[model samples]
Target: MAISSLQEHPGSEVTVWMADGIYPISEPLVFGPRELGEEGTLVFKAQQDAQPVISGGVEISGWIKNSEGLWEAALPKELDETSGFRELFISGKRAARARFPNEGYLRVKQAGVDRRTNFYFQKGDFPIPVNLEGVELVFLHDWSISRIGIQEIDTAADQLIAVDSIGARIPAFFTIDNWEPHPRYFLENAPEFLDADYEWIFLKSQNKVLLKLPQNVNPTNSKVSIPFSQGLIVVEGEENYPVKNIHFEGITFQYSKWEIPEKGYSGIQACHFDPRPSNEGWAVVPAAIISIWSENITFTDCNFRNLGGSGIWFGPGSKNCKIIDSSLKDIAGNGIMIGEGQDRIVNGQPWWKSAPEQVASGNVVENSTISQVGSQFYGAVGIWCGLTAQTAIKNNVLFDLPYTGISVGWMWSPEATPARENIISGNHIHEIMNILSDGGGIYLLGLQPESKVLDNRIHGVKVNAGRAESNGMFLDEGITGVLVEGNLVYDIAKSPLRFHRATTNLVRGNFFFSDDSNPPIRYNTTDEEAIEKVDNLFFSEGEPSYQKELSHAISRWEKKQRKKRKR
Candidate 1:
């Protein structure tokens, strides 16, 4: 009623103050152009010295100890099959889903007769669970992960069949020894797999949750929460009429959920999935807070945590927006995503036909912290930007992720798009690419002209068990006209800088230190003359041997690429 009245009356500026309390919403609060009026500015902020919470979770009570000694709780009758959630929180901490083996993963012994959707497990990997309902098999491929329901367990053949095709459209990403030497997998959301503490499983048929808490921790004394809503807030506008000058401050958004699609999740990189058997379209995991066709929107001093998917997204037709002094952590997918894919081009067309107003540009994210993302999706990144221009990301700390920390650009061809002149500077990225390979602290791709990556401190990139190597910076296919300067990258298992099919990039004034046996730079099937290296200081074991090692590395990489192409 208050908002509708405000839309009717013409006001230059409006402010809504939120008190210190938990505000739970069943659906996303949507704000459109009508809410902003012409030349109007709307602000939603917390009261001074107060903290306001917007939550999408429902509190779960009425716990009872089953005869098996596990605590069970009946979910609300309002929640049905569509309300199935992937995460649970107990007293402000995330609880793990019931997974087999307790630690590490089980390797695929062989590719099944039809390798796309089934794989043979090694002997004694797992026993058939008492119930197969709601059971999912999580497959860890080279650069992506796939989750699918099990169709059958052929114990006699030692094979497992998935309900759908696993991983991306490529066959090498699913079968073992094709792209990756050994594909690892695990079983999830089965009662027989719940062996450790802080584990939970949801039975959809019974509409209940079974939890195994830590020793001597009673469920009656703990507060349990299940995320029920998919999106918390959505700001939308049309092409000509946009939502303008809306600001949010000092608020916390939490506990939004994400559900797997009916066909299953066939992940590509950066939380994007191929959602069809025919590989028709590419889709991304949804964000809890989304702003599209909007301008001059700002989120300052806010918090986003315990989210089942990405935290915030500024999609197509967003411009001059800012996210400053915020914190995003414990998210199941990417912390933030800016812009949309070329396949799903919105509010704009190809560069030759795109209008300046239709492009998402001039966005900024500064002075913030992002950590502990990709909790469930291993292929997710900390921050992902696609087909956007002049996006500035500065002075942020990103760490503790499963894959890349920051990913910019999406197209893999040199054909022109809307991406250009973006800047990533002074960010501290570390401890990323922890579980996945073929990525880095900063991964850049495609034809983003004159983009700059400057003065970033990146370290602690470790080796992984996947096919490709992990690096401090990975410049992948069709990268053109990018400048990498004054960055400090060290302690990487692979080369500090790896270029694959990249062209016309400049690396200068950067300090690269390494303790690994690999060279400081790697050229994988890329022309050496394409990237100009000027005045870069390279140190290995306290000596400068980049010139000698780079020559050897190029030869080895070329030979390896030859063999891979033949395969």
Candidate 2:
């Protein structure tokens, strides 16, 4: 094998030339230390003037009309139902699964948990059929959403019993009107609910699919596909013999799935699927390109879209890697992640352990665009770093995400040993936190001394459902000795900048614009001496270049406050 050959000659060079077509991968492509080819020269690239795509999808055809004028097709026998694929694509566009009450969400009147993992709803609230078993119950909380499976529907007693997840647990206060049942939720994957155009449903047990195609779209003429692979690529190396010199260029990766956790999903802040809790409320999130304990690996001018998890993760011990000039869009989780969550914390202290090479250092993700992430995870960011040190994320455009745009540091404490000297600059992050609240476009946590956020532009934050706040740059608890400068921020539901227990940071030369009634800065319990320098405290003040619209909004708010006082 080429891999064995490469391992035989540790520092040799090899190239994989890919043709210009989609390669549907049913299994993951793993590159371990055995695949490394010395120094940093092993390359995986598309052929000259060719565009190659590595896909996790398999196309379906051979459609015929059913008696009811709907289209039907039999799935390949080799494809099993236990794969847990919930995503389907048609003609390269995502298709909606058959869902009940398509236009509006049904109100959940009253719900209570019971034995066998059952959820009892108020009688007469549910109108779906009793045979609608195996459907997904999509539940939404403050910033968390989960899709649970249905085992039985009791129409007469107004109760739906969920599939038993043995050790699943929920927060005691996460009950109806406490965690608070969202007023809107709908069920999915019932063929009887396939009433709308472009909707689809899979007969899992029968290995068949039913579809309602749009006008002028024939099933054979269009492409219908399902994502079967949960992970498409994995690069693993060891502490002493880390994989080196691996590169991927001009390739497109598409359509991977995230498995529904067997232990049942729990609510993590930011809608991340931390299925089970470890100590300190931490959970694990996975990505498609998961590289562990590797070095000098790179991906350039690539595309990652329609994926089910994070795009690429250079995990603990990965060093000097690069992801540049790429696009990661329409993904369900974070775009790119550096380091691991467990490495970010240990017993409430900064974790600086190095046994398995548990530190991501000197990685670079630059000049790329990532958007529409957290489509399913709801709490994922475009770029995330956890306990990573000396990393650089620059010149990236992050937009249309459900939560934070760029997030660094995960320790949630001021212990500065875990992460340090990171650079986050020259990124355009906007139109984020579109769903979850209590987040910022550029959010920082823990104590990453000398880490900097510079020259970034952020805006377009809105509150949804919960009372949690959303901002442009949120420096959360345990932050210290970082630089925040030259960022243009505005249009936030909360203050443009908020610091909670952050200290010894430099906040200078940054512009802040907001329609919020609160001050430009929300400093809660943070020492007044925390910010070493507050020069240009606010943007363009008292100069001819002062923003007229901002001054006018402030004057209007002042007048309204005065009127309220007089009344």
Candidate 3:
């Protein structure tokens, strides 16, 4: 059969034939406004009757619209002994067991519809029961099949062949065209463009321009800006080259070892390093217009939304970097994560081993909002600081997360030097429930360096009552220097704040009200020592002056702690 582009038109009639002598009429395949083709009709017909056409692995070569409104080319169709193309010909009925082959992998073009189509055999339609272990699906385009599953290829006939590999069993589907590879260039033997004293170099590919900086690279005098026209620029570095720059205006960066598994390319990442001496001082810097990273640099005013892994990430050598004014939504992974590198691999250990040593210190995130994230088990967070130190988070809004609104420490040990010093303050957090093992508003476990929870609002947090426990905030073992103050907690199924062996933590001046009649606030210590019920104005309109005084005292204590650290 010759490959033909299928077009669907409204009210037009066409015929589709199956090997079982069944015939189905044509139907309209609508391609919406976002699709490439104009609305048209598609007709399918069975080949010869004796041929008993078994399109076991037929792939669509280009973009095709399925019966559904969604524009997708890659699908695995199912056919029975009586199912061959005959089943697809039944008029006015949606065809079952239809598979689209895997078209070869391709790069996403800038602004055109680059699509491929393929077909596959559906499980449970085979002539006999066959174990599809190692079936390989071959394609004319350059493509690699990652995984496959048997949806229904069960057959009663003994003549059916068992698939060798999972890939071979995949029904043919159409794929988009492959992306064009970028041209390569060598930088060997190039003359030293700038003085050897400079530490960083900015290269623009379109103009073939290289901006070199002296060893004493300082933002006070020097600034770097690369135009957007530069298509694909490469930044080469020596083994121990130090980066010194403040701005990379209108430039998209491709890092050394960045890749997206499905997409196959690192989109864009812009970075700036601090040009300060003493590489060891602990001070919070002001918000800047660009992304910044120091030995302990900080990132503020950098909006990271609609991008992969949005928000600022501090590497291991990045000692103290803070990310603020940044919004990370519609991306994979939690927004604003701090710890070690994103892809640090330990030699003989799991990937999580390198997590502790990548300590991000004295980081502060304020006034940011993350929402509507699209992952099964990941989503938005007001702030996330794991395996780092002296981090302050305040006045942020996080909602509609698949996990928790604010996640403090995961697999982080307070015993480690410069533990994740997470301070969650004055934030409005809600809608934190989905995963079974999730802690709602704020989740802290293992060893926490120092966590301060103050003046926050938590509402509409859902956790299974009796069967599971969810809290407005949770504190676990090895937790030290925790302060929960002046926060409003309501509509939580479980305890508002549950602390397990959290030592030296203070909970004061917080309002806790629940319509469940009796409020639950479980702690290891008594109300007088562990929690100070001072000046807590509840919905009942009762005021507690003692709680108010304690809240003030806790605030004073935090201020003093900040000052003492500065000293």
lDDT (0 to 1) per candidate: 0.84, 0.74, 0.39
Better of 1 and 3 by lDDT: 1
TM-score per candidate: 0.93, 0.86, 0.46
Candidate order, lDDT descending: 1, 2, 3
Candidate 3 — which residues are off by over 4 angstroms? 1-300, 308-311, 341-358, 379-382, 411-416, 434-437, 446-450, 463-467, 523-567
lDDT of 1 by residue, 1-567 (tens): 546556776665678899999999878889988666756778889999999999999888899888888999888765765648889998868999999978888888887766787888776888688778889998887778888889988888888888877777753445544565457888999988988889999998888899997769997897799888888999999878888888999999988989888667878888988767556557899999999989999999999999988889999899999999999999988899998887653355453245644668999998889999988898999889988899999888899989998999988878777789999987889998888899999998888899999878788888566879899999998888899997878778788899999888899988787764878889997998988999997878455675465455445434644563476
Clashes of each: 0, 3, 97
**18-129 in candidate 3: lDDT tens per residue?**
3442111121122121221222232233344422211111222223333432222222222111111111101111112111211112222221122222222234322221
lDDT of 1 at 214: 70
Q: Candidate 1, which ten residues in sequence have the lowest lDDT sum?
A: 344-353
Give me the displacement of residue 254 in model 2, in angstroms: 1.6
Better of 2 and 3 by lDDT: 2
lDDT of 1 at 445: 87
